[model samples]
Target: MLTFYHAPNSRSTSIRQLILELGVADKVKTVEVTIPRQDGSGARDPKNPHPEGKVPYLTDGEDYVRERAAIILYLTDRFPEAGLGRPVGDAQRGRYLSWLIWYQGVLEPVTILNWAKLDHPAVKASLRDYDTALQRLDEVLGRQPYLLGDDFSAVDLLCAGPFAWFGDQMPATPAIRDWVARCMDRPAVRETAER
Candidate 1:
């Protein structure tokens, strides 16, 4: 059985939602652990196997996976029956991987910097600004319902998660807003939230 270390209301919620979507909740063991929050309310849990003491870490036998994008990839690929991940031969595989990486590499950092009001020139030059990130999302969501064309996949879960949690901070663009709504409307997402 896979062991999932999660923290409620943190980024791990996305993983929990994915697990529910995959219908593998019974197969995996969820170990809720507290993590240091931005507001300094929680403490780092020694039980969390993540080296950084973060939530959303997964362990399977001797193997372990950390980081949201990596874990998403691992679970989706491991449980391909859910069709949340694009397999290697699928045409959208490259696009799928790109969106996953972009969420963690670019979108997240930009959102954090903008929220903290630390959008320095160097940071903007390196990671670009929040507007730029929003523009990218708007452009793609405007064309299709999901990041990878018509299919609702893990990429949508990853990309739309932040907006679902922080909708007030998200832009008023209809495309992005609607896409987020569609992503958040899923029963799995609702179940995760209720937990």
Candidate 2:
């Protein structure tokens, strides 16, 4: 059986939601672990495969997958029957992959910096500011309901996870707001969010 290590309300929640969206909840077992707290006083679960004791890591048999983007890509590709991944030769596959990489590479860092108010010229130059990220997302979302276009995919869920949680940090773009709303409206997302 597949094992998923996660903590409620943490980055791992997105993985949980993705599993739910795949309708493979019964196929995998979820192991909840305490994450490192802001004060650095939480449990560093030995059972968790994450090197830093982070949540949202997945154990597939003897192999371990860490990082949100990696976990999402692993699960979606592993269970292609869910239709969440754009397989090879698909026209949208490139766009799909780009969104996945962009989420971790750009959006994640930008959100953290903006939230902490740690603005620096170098940081802005390397990893665009929050407003720029929002504008780019708005442009894509305005063109289609999901990152890969009309159909919802794991990219939608993965990308939406951050925006849904950090709605306050996002700009007042109707497209972004609507896309996030659509993502949150999914039954799987609501269930995982409640957990």
Best by lDDT: 1
Writing each residue's lDDT as its tens digit, candidate 2 over 116-152 gives 8898999989998889988998898988898888888
Evaluate model 1: give its lDDT: 0.92
Q: Which ten residues in a row have the lowest lDDT in candidate 1?
A: 165-174
Q: TM-score for every candidate vs. truth?
A: 0.96, 0.94
Q: Mind giving the per-residue lDDT tens digits that candidate 1 earns over 47-125?
A: 9989999989999999999999999999999999999999889999999999999999999998888887885888888
Off by over 4 Å in 1: none
lDDT of 2: 0.86
151 in model 2: Cα distance from truth in Å?
1.2
For model 1, what is the error of residue 86's alpha carbon versus the real structure, in angstroms, after optimal superposition? 0.5
Give Cα-based local distance difference scores for all models: 0.92, 0.86
TM-score of predicted model 2?
0.94
Which residue pairs collide in model 1, if any?
A: none
* Candidate 2 Cα misplacement greater than 4 A, ranges: 39-41
